[model samples]
Target: MPTYPLLAPPPLSSGSPSAHPPSIVTSLVPPMFNAQAEESPKNLILKKVMNELDRINNGMNKSITLNSPTINDLEDCCVKSALNCFQSKVLYLSVPDGKLKKLQIIISNELHKIVNRVSDCKPKELEKAQCKPCDSYKEVDSQTFVQNLKTLLQKIYASQP
Candidate 1:
């Protein structure tokens, strides 16, 4: 009687099974590849806002380091630059009416505080011949402002359809 030949399994070296050769079926199939989807308009806007905030933060740090002689000078330089950067970015962004109103209020409040602090630190001349003690510079809490902006951005992004 004639017998048919049988295929043998791959040899195993020690007790562990040997690695199997690449299968033609798997090779023919496409690799587990996924294309990255494009970001939504809201996401893009949020990213731009975050980037602008970063730029403002960096500018503040640079101004602080360079104008360290007087606390007033440091505060003036840093605050002015930060406000300018923020204002420019705000103007550039075209937020929806609902979010725009909220953003405007928050930004206005923060700016008011900054402006008041700056005014308070300004040197005033006395009418009399006597010199007066200068008011100490009040540090602006930008971290809180930035955090609030980030929270607002998150809300805006979430609310987007």
Candidate 2:
């Protein structure tokens, strides 16, 4: 009988340092939102929006980890596509543009709308995913984090304005 060669497992974390030939994935800085910090109410609203968006985004990350295909699967697709970099496919949807600043505001606003629609998930649904149940009374820091991010993003936008 002939023995098959053993295969190495994919990196457990995204962008691990051990990835040979260091991936060419460039670091991206999300564009700033507004020109003046004190002049815009957009910061506050955007902050509120980002808070909600972060929750859903983070939940999606957790869901993928719990139920979706792993990086190994993506690697197979990359090989089939003849793509050299896995990072490239991960970011293909985010082709950066000079107008990213404006686009972000619109996106953030839309995200806020979506977040509003889905902020509360049924307890049973969360349980089905093996996630901790949400507490109606417990404090969530997402609001503050989102607010800070928005302020920072606003500053970035202001620079372009």
Estimate every model's Cα lDDT from 0 to 1.
0.41, 0.35
**Which clashing pairs does model 2 show?**
32-156, 32-157, 33-153, 33-157, 34-157, 34-158, 35-158
Kindly provide the TM-score of model 1 when superposed on the true structure, using C-alpha atoms.
0.32
Residue range 34-124, candidate 1, lDDT tens digits: 6867776446656566555555543332212110112223332243333433443333333345545455445444543433333222333
Give the best candidate by TM-score.
Answer: 1
Candidate 1 Cα lDDT to native: 0.41
Residue range with the least summed lDDT across 10 consecutive positions in model 1? 62-71
Residues 1-161 of candidate 2: C-alpha lDDT, one tens digit per residue: 43423333345446574763434334344666788566344444445445544543343222111111222223221221211121112222231343543443554455444333323445565444442222211332433333333443344334332
TM-score of each: 0.32, 0.22
Identify the runs in model 1 with alpha carbons over 4 angstroms from their true place: 1-22, 33-36, 61-143
